[model samples]
Target: MHIAEITAVMKLPSNVRYEYFIKKVTDFEEVWGLFSDAWATSKDEDGNLFIPFFPKKEFAEISAEKEWALYKARSISLDDFIEKWLAGMKKDGIIPSIFPLGNDMAAVSIDVLLKDLEMELENY
Candidate 1:
């Protein structure tokens, strides 16, 4: 995907983008994230840290600018994301920011994401 396509996806409504994230990740069996020395993260007004993920590498690539300049897009297999990452993130109280577009994102809990992904996969 290119920047133009990404821009269109970004313009999509929050719930639509969230659905797109889940579908794309499950369809590809992978999720994209920006990483350098650590995973790329953002904070809410309350100062809670959340790691952002993308359903497409292009999304991650476009986000890897400014403060995230040193970060590179990396792919995480869905299985690892589910069986390992999610549980660890849940224990650590880290929110998963799905398909963020600027200041907007679907910042959901690990359990919520897991349940949604499971439901989506059930249709397959």
Candidate 2:
């Protein structure tokens, strides 16, 4: 069910995908990201490191390309995300790339993602 929904959502624009990412993560209490030797990361023009996350494993899996070719989709619990990952990433100056499809994504600050996730959780 969700797999099909995500497939359709993936075809939409990045902003819509980002909103779905937040909702699905909040609803499922899990986040998916690619991992191999270490978690996959990319740099913006300013050299800011970003770790892309998805609301579905299929989304993460599809993103595995080139440098991420050996990566596998890994799940992170929402509790860990809110309690540990977010703070650690904030301190490390890493941003979250939400629902990245191709080169387009919503790269948001840790604070913003934290707030959005918290707000989404409130709806449940």
Candidate 3:
């Protein structure tokens, strides 16, 4: 039931831009978790610190349909929330590599590599 490789990153071809690699991870919670974890230095109104990143429990609370649209609105600047997360992933060295002609291939492969992919958080 476990795939250790889900957490493992592999090498992509050399032609794709790393930035767009960040742009394709539009699955809502995936983008939210990655970004929330990476830039979690924000504070709440009362000055108590609040991290946007979801815990496993919180993630489990999301429904696949709504989370995507909601998170997309919150996270994505151009294409989708996943793409934005891909940018964050690249910043954190989470993505392996990319190629020009193999852009679609690279994204698909990356998704395979991160096989723990779930849409649970997409419920919003």
Candidate 4:
């Protein structure tokens, strides 16, 4: 199975950093599909989709409040948002690559965020 780790960092209003990590066994296409659906379903008569301010399970790990807000407030198309988001992730080296061929056993340290954000994978 292919595993990807998603880390999101947000600077709250009080300067208290909020960081969350999500790890899942999914690929880029699946991730894209979720966002596409969200955009399509949320589109208004003006063709603008207002994305939620915070990360949700549907959207992949995303950072930067300004960029996200700008996209939503400006009514950027879903295509544009997807391209920009993917490009940014690639530029930052956060885009997960395809799983290695023939790798049956792989392990990754993932933060289990159910109860506490700081919880480690080993403990779970």
Best by lDDT: 1
Quote each prediction's TM-score: 0.94, 0.93, 0.21, 0.18
Error of 1 at 32 (Å): 0.4
Ranking by lDDT: 1, 2, 3, 4
> RMSD to the native, candidate 2?
1.5
Query: What would the per-residue lDDT of candidate 2 be over residues 13-120, giving only the tens digit for each residue?
Result: 988888899998998999999999899999978898999999988888889988899999999999998899989999998998898887899988888889899998
TM match of model 3 to true structure: 0.21
Answer with 2 or 3, whichever has the higher TM-score: 2
Tell me how far the alpha carbon of residue 77 in candidate 4 is from the true structure, in angstroms, after superposition: 5.0
lDDT per residue (tens digit) for residues 67-110 in model 3: 23233112333233335554565455443322112122232333
Winner by TM-score: 1
Candidate 1 lDDT over 26-80, as tens digits, reads 9999999999998998888898889999999988988898889999999999999
User: Which window of ten consecutive residues has the lowest lDDT sum in model 3?
Assistant: 55-64
Report lDDT (CA) for all predictions.
0.91, 0.90, 0.31, 0.26
Which should have the higher lDDT, number 1 or number 4?
Answer: 1
Q: Which regions of candidate 4 fall more than 4 Å away from where they truly are?
A: 1-77, 96-124
- lDDT string, candidate 4, 1-124, tens digits: 1123222222222112212222221111122212321331122346533222222332322321332332321133333434564455445433221111111111121221222222322343
| Cα-lDDT of candidate 4 | 0.26
Error of 2 at 86 (Å): 0.8
